[model samples]
Target: MGFREGNLGALGHGIRHRTTITTCLLMAVFFVCYTNREFLRFPVEHELSTALDDHPPNTLKLSDVQGVSTVSGDHPANSLTLSDAQCTALFPHAFDEIELALSRGPVKRSLDKITNGHVRARIYNGALYLTDRGLDVWHRQSAILHQIHRAIVTAPSPSELPNINFEFSVNDHPSGDVWSLARSDADKQVHNTWLMPDFGFWSWPEPHIGSLDEVHDRIIKTEGSMTWEEKESKAVWRGTVKWNKGLRGKLLDVAWDRPWSDVQRLNWSSNALAMEDFCRYKYLIYTEGVTYSGRLRYFQMCRSIIITPELKWHQTTSPLIRSAGPDQNIVIVKDDWSDLAETIEYLEANPEHAERVANNTVRTFRDWYLRPAVETCYWRKLFRAWAHVTPPVGQLYPEERGTRWESFILMHRLHWGKNA
Candidate 1:
């Protein structure tokens, strides 16, 4: 019994020693692991922080227009710069359809038809008139589409048709997911807006489509007849205020009643003032309302210098101003419009420079947008590229079963242009 007790006691002591040694080794391993982790953290953190600081998102070179980086209400890094010069059309055969359309003479007829659940421009004796949709909304799309339709009617075109079946895009951005508009039952009975490759929406057929003051300088320039010397020196702006909630209102608040500029809310009903009258002034304030302004094109027609903030949403008109840059064709300010008052003051003080800038602006617009062949050329490129990329189903506006828009193209094509 005594030997057994001694042996048990010895075994207990041996077990205790083994446990202590194992515990010590485990503690040493844990201490080493903890120390190693603590040692690695500082360098890893520094390297990660350095990487983030060194290369932030959307970092761009000064001249790089490869990508657009925009913050809401703030001008992006490369917003107004132009991409490298290249041919406007993606493919060579882009204008064949347009050429064919232009060659077919006197496709003209007059119609007094009301669009079914649609609003469209009607041609009468080569004049354009808008069908009353009775939308009564003072938004950008309605106003711009109205103006472009008017331009289509009044502006000279390659095809001098008094009547034709027209299909085109809405000039303004429709309010909602743009892609969804295509997926669902298209409002085909209504004028549909389609996306062009670069920017802006395009529509078809009635289009003839800019700026210069001198009889020598003018080609299709219908407005802004006065020379820069004869014009009012103050900067002038007229537009509706409902959609341009923040930045535009700030413009009015700063410039209204100031001696150097004239700013007023546009009265929609009155066509009393002609576009030329507005252009007769030396400076025009160009700002975006809902998306982009079709008004910029009209301003281009006059001799006045266009002054605008750094552009956010470029309508189809942006590429025309690419070669012109900020200083030449149009004066660019900060998106916050920090420079509006100052720019007006400077232009008012330096009349000759302003005149020179105005002339250059008109000259740039003339070369870019107002040439005799541009109307046909633009359509040709647009149509050709569209054929190349757009699928067969897309050729006809997307249709829903039993919807009016689905039957719209066929119905119009068959029946329209019957009357003279």
Candidate 2:
């Protein structure tokens, strides 16, 4: 009896050991498969690193005798540094050619004159301005402005221009325009508006659009369409204006003209909202008799839809505030005002669908609209603009370094969050 009991005990122990071993093996296999899958999925070229560096065969050395002038001792100040000269030589005739080409077009119209027009121009520091009135007539309304700018900056002369020709067809009207011409047109517009300097097109240009009021009033209207709808249940209405200007306009045009999936459309909409809330909603519904500031008012005007999530609306001084609740309700009550009554009433009446809608809206803002990715992109763009205005190396300015450090911090924070 004792021997049989011992055998049974040993057999149970063996069974437990086998089970533990099998589990561990399975887990190991899973981990390997998961890791390998990602490794294999990445593009091979992207994963590879070349051993050889293909820098320019020769670098130019700057000396006192090389027509280089120094402001203090051997260092230059305001004068073009070696790096600046190198950059200029890399893209010789870019600025002059752009200016000349843009001049060939009709005089650009002023901000006050055009009802609906777009000035897709770049600005530099505070010089070399370009405006719609400054450019010639034919190139003023050209859609290939960006292309033209790129051509003239990268390859100013016709001989320097790329051999490849870009053609665009609008209702069977195919225009065989040279890339350089398009870039020239774009550069001209950018220069005229003083936007080229800010964007590294020309040198530093002054800020053209000053106050938001001027921006709002002077924005060139496009021949686009807008759709409006009122929510039957809530005191809110939604509107969306489809314009033929800006990046969103270009994207929408491409999507509609080409074969795009519903997922793509949704992605585009979400991305558009991520960039600017103006594209998602046009109006902000508020309680009547409440006076709003210009900035807040402008936000409402640009928004496509407005809804009052709060119960009571009162006038106060504060910007729009996003509320955090289980329903993801957004309360835009004036500062120091309570709209609890109206909000409660709406929630109670639409209990069935209110929570779901609010949750969905909140998710959109949290995941896409206000995510780190979008903010990072904005900061990157801002940094690029700053870099464009910075003086060349050896003639470095204090502000440039400060801006660079600030940008670096912003970028780091964006990537790793505050904890990082």
Alpha-carbon lDDT, every model? 0.47, 0.29
What is the TM-score of candidate 1?
0.46
Candidate 1 Cα outliers beyond 4 Å, as residue runs: 1-168, 174-225, 268-272, 322-327, 392-420
TM-scores, one per candidate: 0.46, 0.20
Candidate 2 lDDT, tens digit per residue, 1-420? 999999999999999999999999999988987656444333421212110022211121223223333444431211222222222232222234323424444332223432222322222221111232222332223323332333233321223221211112111111111111122122222222111211112111122323332333322121023322221222221122232123223333332432211112223334322212332332234332111111232232232323442322111111113355453334453322234335435554665444454334433332222222222222222223223333322332333222222243235221244555
CA lDDT for candidate 2: 0.29
lDDT top scorer: 1
* Each candidate's clash count: 5, 58
Per-candidate RMSD vs. true structure?
22.0, 27.4
Residue 386 in candidate 1, Cα distance off native in Å: 2.1
